[model samples]
Target: MQSPAEDSTTHAPTRDCDVLVIGGGPAGSTASTFLARRGWRVAMLEKDAHPRFHIGESLLPMNLPILERMGALDKVAAIGVRKSGADFPADGGGYNVFRFERALDARCDHAFQVRRSDFDRVLFEHAAGEGVDARQQLRVVSVEPLACGGSLVSAIGPDGPCSWRARYVVDASGRDAFLGGKRRIKRRNTRHQSAALFSHFEGVERREGVDAGNVSIYRHAHGWIWMIPLPDGVTSVGAVCYPDYMKTRRGDSEGFLMRTLRTVPEVAQRMAAATRCADVHATGNYAYECTEMAGKGWVLVGDAYCFVDPMFSSGVFLGMHGAEQAAGMVDAALREPAREAALQQALRRHIDAGTDEFKWFIYRFTSPAMRHLFANPRNVLQVEDAVVAMLAGDVFDNPRVRRRLRVFRALYAVTSLAMLPRALRNGLRRRRQSRVDFSGETLQAEES
Candidate 1:
């Protein structure tokens, strides 16, 4: 994939659309595809070109229905490499492999891991093929909400400045919610603060049995590491560390990623057998939320509303879920005048649920005890199924997860007493193993 710097030639100036989707990530693509299918003239703008490189390559089985609904299931499946489940490898020799099909969440019976570059491109092409007017390299420069209750969007594409008007807008704009910026509604999350450094590689360790197609979570002192296998032989590896742990790094991504990976014995060994394919990349403090998810003339979808951490690969799942709601909301707003208000309210509620669903686990992932639990042997079939449901990203309509989430929350409070000895012993061992540079400030215990 070429860098934005390399693709300097913008397309000829253009305009006009019923719905304008900014950002062609999973959220934008899903929303745009659905809107276009609804017979709305949808035009999508993507700052980055398709086949663009990106991290976060894992998927949940529940997301397949959205792809199917968009008529891209076969296409996605073709490009997709099947993901049976996830595996957790801790500091000790213990490893846990979880298959979503084995869980109570029947929706996520299966999933996949695609190179984001290919995955994003597939979805974009699907949206365009579905008759949505869309283009890449069109950067949204300014968004002006008009007095008539509409919006005027000025953009800088491969060419020069151009403008377009829309009666209503869908901020399907992934993480960099352009409209959210204009609304001055972006808010940072304080719980489970973290940073990440990632890169792709070939020859990374993968289980040959049922584990051959799986994601591996390896624990480290600073935090944890993720290994995702793609359709191709290459595997995606990333290191997630607390904000304080990152502060001790030399401020260089490649060095930081390599250094952090080396900290985890399992990840270090697997990476040692593999080779990096590109420059190491890094992102920081993964939390952002908008004040209101919906408005008089627009609604937020995907990361436009809020983004929790990527620990459970919920970004794509939540984004697709939001699109599911927005498709209905947008359809209603266009069909009936009275339903418009109610539609926006529904979108806001959807966003709230999406945020809470992901935030719950984001907070738990950082729990030292939780991490250890995955490392050690503890199997309550129901708890395993509940967690598998959560990992499946089936928060939408998952009464099982919601109930178990409550149970876990209460269990965590009580288990704090039982795990006190284990926590203290592990904490001290980790402290001695890694250089404790940060002040002894404990991380917050919430996910979102």
Candidate 2:
């Protein structure tokens, strides 16, 4: 663990570490701990305090093996929050609830619904305690790749500020790459754009059976909502909206979130007499991509590389999976100079696969046809089970996911025509309304 003195040192450390990691989210936490366990001296800097609020409470069924490999399952299970599966509600007044039991991999029959604040803090604390030179509340103000053979990172924190020179720097900085600005690699995506507002409450209505312990998706006219059940009986509910729908809100974050909920009958009925957990939370312009996720001396993990719609619960899974793939390369890059070219290529391939996996569902998630299809399940007999598994987050390590995703890609390409055209039509109508002859409403007195 990093001591208080280390937190305040101003000058860069004369001694270098095997790896310097910025950001203490799950990806950073996992990478630092894993590398440390392999006998490498690892240093991690987190900009925020522990137990800080975060989203993405729903876990994919596949997250267990990674947690187990990190030897943190007991820690995770200690604060275990039960999440049986998902219930997808559609705009056409229909839905179907799917459980992990229906998955081809029955071993992954369940996942947890956690408060990200607690869940992330646990990983950070564990990594620190496990001998990674970890510092909480440490912000990386600057990152300078050494001219010769390392990188220097300057950071600010509660105690004061500090910096270090590291042979290899792992940019597990989530989406807010402290170094991203330096590289000018971050930019928003407009084609498949989105925004979101979320909050937690204790009394949100839940369904019976597996559905009660599951996350619910309620589709509305403008967008879709997610209801996630957490361990302490608090449910996290949020909605992701299209760019144009987001523009209508202006500054009415709370009112907009509440009103959108009412647009969905099932969600409105459920929240009829419910109360807010805290103030309504809002986030917008929620799409971005980084031109570079890795480099000769660093790798960006989790949201730092790219982010799309969060509908699929791929945020945490993809983030940590990227860290896992970066592990082998980081291990090699630490000692072997000749291995970097191969490592960078491997890193790019891995990032591409992760992004493709995530983009598959995100592109189709908001399509009316997708909403229709999920609301009413179908397909050839050959693809049903695999589709179910894919929906359940059983993509990794399963060759079946590729075959099923290919089929889904075809389904979306054709069915989306009917949906995208309607969405475009609605946007055009709204734009025309905004342009209506407002001059008539104004009195002629000013002209006179």
Candidate 3:
């Protein structure tokens, strides 16, 4: 088959826009919408159509402000299940619940649990309504940065081969990492390696009142499971586990997932009356980061630049926030070309700061000490409040919040030392589990 660049040569340039955005997920839509609102001509290409099924349905409280700013708050709220807190159930009959309202930032006291398909479509449509030339079923196959400036983006749309000479390119290409893959900057996150298996179900039990939409996390012997209640009464359930544990599956994905669900008491009890509503899905190597995020006339956003674990439901928040930051940087670059380097550096620093704050907790999530801390939260030095702030994605502009997190980290170190034996054993086991023998087993995805 002819390459995207080769095919582009055969067809005339279909269109031109000031900014060309690849991927129409949270990141792409947010960037496109923001640029379009600023009176910049923007064109977005999405490989898949909207309303498509996707995992990572939970949303952080911090995402509310972004949505409100985009004029999508009411649209999203109409379809969302109000989520005020998070529930963590331990294997030893201990449970801890963290309410967003208790966080340092009171503005972001609550969020919503949504179906990604519906949530993403709301944002994608908002971008189009803002005058973005949003095209669905169009995949950006290759990007060639021009010698002088800008880029030549080649894509395959429903009409056939197409191309565009864009002044700037914003890559929000989810896990495809189009720009990162092309530049060979994509690197697996060795610190945390794991996979997920998930499916939706009807009849999963949920709490009453405001807690009905709270996401429930259950810790099992092997890993953890999340149960999120959607507006339509469907519950999204998934398990994140090590490759070694996943390799023991002897049957199809559906059977394996069902058997695994039974291993977690809370998840099994809640799912006992539930009926499967979707096909089983699996994705491996959950953590990755791109070495570079921005250059000359191009910038990477969302999962295109990096993806950490979804344990704290930070995926959507980070993606949308990154898009907002990248849009500002791109706007600045378009107006003041001389400051491009500084603007790019600022964007990189912004992304790194957000990811780094979450990385610490995610890296130690499965450790004995971290688990103990989360399972038995304390308010000494307002550490629990700081953690709640972090979970709410409030670490970006709050100096007071960051300081509290530092104190919490110091406390964690001291606690870990107190439980040295258990911490060491857990650390060793985690190290072994993090090393996956990819040559021996591939990622599994089976139908029910």
Candidate 4:
């Protein structure tokens, strides 16, 4: 992708739109589709062309409803591997699978594991089909607030420089956090920081029958690993570890990824005969969130607003869900200027409500207590089912699920107290590990 820098001589005419969406990933596409369907003059700009490679490939059962709403579920399913649920290593050996059907809400019982290249293109094209003036390879260069209201957004595309006068802006630029970074509101998470290395592979052993498509997770001393079954007999395997452990790399990222996989007996066995089919990708210090989600004329959604961890495969769901909600909020705000503040506030609360629930578990995911509980989950007070619901991305507006989640948190607290000594040791280790520096590397994907 070319830089967003514009050439002075290539200026094109400025277009007018009700909403100018930056970035055409899931969030941007969904928002554009919804707005355009509502008769708004919506324009979406994407830095890269469709069918581009992206890392997050897993989807939760909760995502089914949204996809169905957008009329793209069938398309996604056709190109995806059927993923019934997720699984984790059991303390007593074997694996403990949490089927989506077992959750409190079983209506959306299944999801698909897709190659994001295909998945994202489907959504982007769907948006264009829905009347959005979607354009690719247009990197937004600047967004300056207009004195009369709205903003002027400029970009440089194949046709050279172009601009848009937009009433409201939707910043869905993924991890670039365009507006957030520009305003200096993006903050790296202090409590939890992590790095990852991943690649696609073939010949990796997959579970048979009903479990063949489940995402497998294994906990290691320094971090955790994920094995997502993608279509075409390929698996997306990745390890998310602390910066301290990642900084110990002795060679190339591929070697480091292979060595990390070998450390986990379960993953190593599965990948023993696997042949890498793609280049190894590396990313570091990815956990972060913007202090503000919205302002006078704009709102941020998906990774542009905040990102915690991808342990539960919430990235795509959260992004699309936020876009769905943001579209509504933006619609209402456009009609009722006096209510814009309240609408943006509600949007932030809505996104954060689910995010906070996930954060509680994510912050403690690598702890001994969390590992023990997950490995030996019980249905005591139906807490396990509630957890399954949470994992399914059902964290919003479910009273029954919320009640049980509270119980689960209490249970976790008591368990932590019981394992106080071990908990303390793990906490200290995590703190020390998080403080370790990796020079100055951020998220980056490279070839072999």
- As for lDDT, the candidate ahead, 2 or 4, is 4
lDDT of 2: 0.75
Indicate which candidate wins on lDDT: 4
Question: What overall lDDT goes with each candidate model?
Answer: 0.76, 0.75, 0.87, 0.89
Q: lDDT tens string, model 3, 209-296?
A: 8788898887655678888999778999998887667766666788877877887666778787999999999999889999999988
* Model 4 per-residue lDDT at 284: 79
lDDT of 4 by residue, 288-399 (tens): 9999999998999999999988999999989999999999999999999999999999889989998888888899888778888999999998899999998899998788
Between candidates 1 and 2, the one scoring higher on lDDT is 1
TM-scores for every candidate against the unseen true structure: 0.89, 0.89, 0.93, 0.93
RMSD in Å for model 3: 4.7
Instruction: Give the alpha carbon lDDT tens digit for every residue of 244-320 in model 2.
Output: 55655633677768877887778888887678876688777688878876777887777887777777777887777
Determine which window of 10 residues in candidate 4 has minimal summed lDDT. Answer: 439-448
Candidate 3: regions farther than 4 A off? 1-8, 90-94, 425-448
Error of 2 at 84 (Å): 2.1
Q: Considering summed lDDT, which 10 consecutive residues are worst modelled in model 2?
A: 439-448
